[model samples]
Target: MSGDFDTIRDASSSDEVQLVRLLEEKIKSLQIEIENLRKELNYYKAEMEKMLSPPLIEAVVLDVLPDGRVLVRSSSGPNLVVNVASHIDQKLIKPGVSVALNQRGSTILEVLPQKEDPIVKTMEIVEKPNVTYSEIGGLEEQIKELREVVELPLKKPEIFREIGVEPPKGVLLYGPPGTGKTMLAKAVATESNAVFIHVVASEFAQKFVGEGARIVRELFEMAKRKAPSIIFIDEIDAIGAKRIDIGTSGEREIQRTLMQLLAELDGFNPLDNVKIIAATNRIDILDPALLRPGRFDRIIEVPLPDFRGRTEIFNIYLKKMKIEDNINLELLSQLSEGFSGADIKNVCVEAAYMAIRDGRNKVTMKDLVDAITKINVKRNNMESMKERREKYS
Candidate 1:
């Protein structure tokens, strides 16, 4: 009876061990199942959130309503009255502030930071040019006026205030090509150490309607933000041409761009330290309004340099060049009448090239004469072609 009892006790112990092992296995399986369920729940939650999200659109604030709503011009081609989100501060909902709008509800989701317009950003001069006042020659009077008009206003505004006279708002540098109008602007920019933005008028005239005007707005806004800046518009005639009673959509868009530019020049917001310099070869074609006293206070004509001016230009270009001692600049200046400062520089460059081609160390008087003769021949050929075209037309 004792032996039977021992065998039964051992069997009972073994069965208890097996039961415990089974229970452990069941708990482990349940934990894994619970983890998988949580993962599935998370995945469903993400999908639900995606479905709940709405598309956001970009818009520019036009005006603020008295009742606390805002007027926005959507990028999608319509002006809208959108509700500002309750969480957003009302102060940042002012006109001109960019905002993100919910497409479904037509509400401003968030006030967006003003982004730098890519076009205007490219227009600004990132690195100031390596040009200075000394480098510019034969435009002493022009440089003087530019300093007083652009530099003084930014550097010493008190002088104008003390004299009880308002400084010029803008300067126009009109001239034939290569007379150094653009170079003068560069000198002023370097001397004043101000932000220089150089943009061509053709670029300002966008093909799309209202696009050009928008660029003008952003341009002036940027200039204002970067105070004590210079805005040089080369070839102003492209957009500033006289307005016509009737024209194509493209022409109308350019006129619109010009109107925006005029508005900016004579706008209510006074240009404190910002100065404008516009250059054009065809000043006659420009609108009369653009040349007005208030808009462009100084209409400086950078005409062809005189003989003395030519001499100065020659000296400026020849100073650094290695030439024979027999090189008489005054004679060269006299021989090269009607040649622009740029032409004179080109002559010097051509002389250098001739010497290099001949395996010579220094530019000789013959080299200078050869370059001048070569350029004169080219000019004569161009003039003959132009005359033939005119005669044919």
Candidate 2:
């Protein structure tokens, strides 16, 4: 009886071990299937996202095919399709040849401020001259110097090579507040007949991260591609401020923009045509790297005009104004000492008021004298002038 009980016990123990081994194998197989399902689900989810949300239509360009099939690239990577009813026919822009992408379920567009208008781009490239050299008076030396540097690249590139003097890459017009630095830059654009891109520091700060740097690169590229172009950055200190601590995300972005601008400017070798002209009232506040040899190397001082320069400026402005025979511009130039060209323009405008009050057709010396005196005296005395303007209103 004891031997029989031992055999039964051994059989039971072997059966229990076999059952446990089967259960372990089942669990391992289940885990492998679960992992494979998870990978398959992830891949399906990615495909779904792509179908739901697509990239923005970056650009719309017209492409004429060899077989005469007018095609358009929407830049969104969609198959080209056209709506015959929505197209226009024009010489510059042909429609029917036009196609657009349907932006559906896009999250990227939501991040941007507003939808950009395609029509505005056409207006931007239109060339128009604002102020010509003939419009500016005085500072003949400065104008002549700038003309040679700016115009030679366009008018006579061969002469420039023979002279062995590469046209200046950039010109820095630095001076006291209200000097003719801005005027000088405009004149360069007019005389050279180049595309002008005007940028101020205020505009730089307003741009979003990476946007400013992108604009800088694009503008430089544009200037290079459209050789014989001038890029004028006014009050450069605002954009080119010193690189301080990159403690904040904003600061880091600004640094990135500045570094990109520096790189673009450095890498740009004009096909011997484009030039950069920057102006700053506070040169001391600019970054050291910007003032180095290749960038803004020729720092021209636009000091307060001397007596002769002032006299010439007076004559130019007076040419258009209705002036009496007795208005003696030379005397007015001498009297308006320590004044900027802008200040002189203001004086001329103010003198016109006096002529109007006197019921005269032209301005006179007495009118200017009174205008000068009115400008210098404390504003407390201008109550009558203020009252007159208000009364008229």
Candidate 3:
């Protein structure tokens, strides 16, 4: 009976030891799981904080109040009296500097560095155009005038200063479509070696209110920063149209943009090294304000190429073409009456296409004539369609 009792005690002791080891292992696993759960909880907490934070809005510093308060004008909202955060430097808070505001737009979160507006950055032309003065034909006088007005001012600033005159503020190129106005602007941009910013007047007609005017302001400001810059506004009539009281929101937006543009053109802020070149097909409809002296110093007309001009244009376009011996450029020029330089180039291109379609290596007079006929037919059809639309309307 004593041995039996001792054996039972030993068995109980072994079972108890095994149970204790199992419980230790279980506790270790539970501790590891708890640590993993804690790490996951920390990650979720950070994510929630970020999600709950409010977005910052842009604002401009209007004035610094005497009692640690700031007068800031929100870009998308009205003016507000705000308090600057402690982290931001006090010295940097001044008028005209842009700042970031809190969600309610009542607290100045931080002061932002003066940087080029995104719209201005996108409009900058980094690559020089391949078109040069030589490639342009029959606009010798126009090109010469442009050089004097646009290029000369940039190339030789002292000449103007010595002559006791401000260099021309801007040049306006107005003419029919496809008459090389844009090409002339390109040549000027290439020759002057100034930063070129090309923007369509219609681009300023934004859908949102105040956006158009803002863009215009930013555009000119950018030009001022990047001094020795050329701003080419194509289709000027879009924004330069005469303003009227009876109008839609779109029209109001356009008028606002035009007002901003006029202010920039002849504003109190002298456009020191900046120059403007505007092109339009409809000069008659331009506002009287825009046509005045101080804004656009010179308004040059780019007309259709005449007989002699057409001949020169033909030679220029045909210089590289593989032509048959009998193809008379003079006759082609005489035949291309009322054709613009752009039209003549298209004729040359169409003639080459004709030759290619015929599986030939050279262009002939017949091919040229056919191309001209095709272009004329297309032009007539376009005219008839336009007339019909007008008649019906």
Each candidate's lDDT (Cα)?
Answer: 0.83, 0.67, 0.83
Per-residue CA lDDT of model 2 for 1-393, tens digit only, reads 999999999899999999999999999999999999999999999999988875545333233345433344455565453322223332222311223334541211211222333321222331444777776666777888887777667677788778666666778888876668888887777777877767675466564554667667556645554556677878777677786667987767677767877886676553356678888887887888887776667777788877887777778788889887787878988887777787677778888988898788898888887776766563435557879898999
Deviation from native of the Cα of residue 344 in model 1, angstroms: 0.7
Q: Write the per-residue lDDT of candidate 3 for residues 1-393, one digit (tens) a residue.
A: 999999999999999999999999999999999999999999999999999998898987756789989987788878899999999999888766789999988788888888766665667463455568998888999999988888888888878878877766888999989999988888887888777778887766743356888888877766654557788899889999786663687887788888898987876222256789999998998988998888876899999998888888888888889998897877888888988888889999999999999999999999999998888888789889989999999
lDDT of 3 at 174: 93
* Candidate order by decreasing TM-score: 1, 3, 2
Clashes of 3: 0
TM-score, structure 2 vs. true: 0.63
Lowest summed lDDT window (length 10), candidate 2? 105-114
Q: In candidate 1, where is summed lDDT lowest over 10 consecutive residues?
A: 267-276
Q: Using TM-score as the measure, name the better of candidate 1 and candidate 2.
A: 1
Report lDDT (Cα) of residue 323, candidate 2: 88
Candidate 1: segments with Cα more than 4 A from true spot = 1-112, 206-210, 268-271, 390-393
Q: Which candidate is the best by TM-score?
A: 1
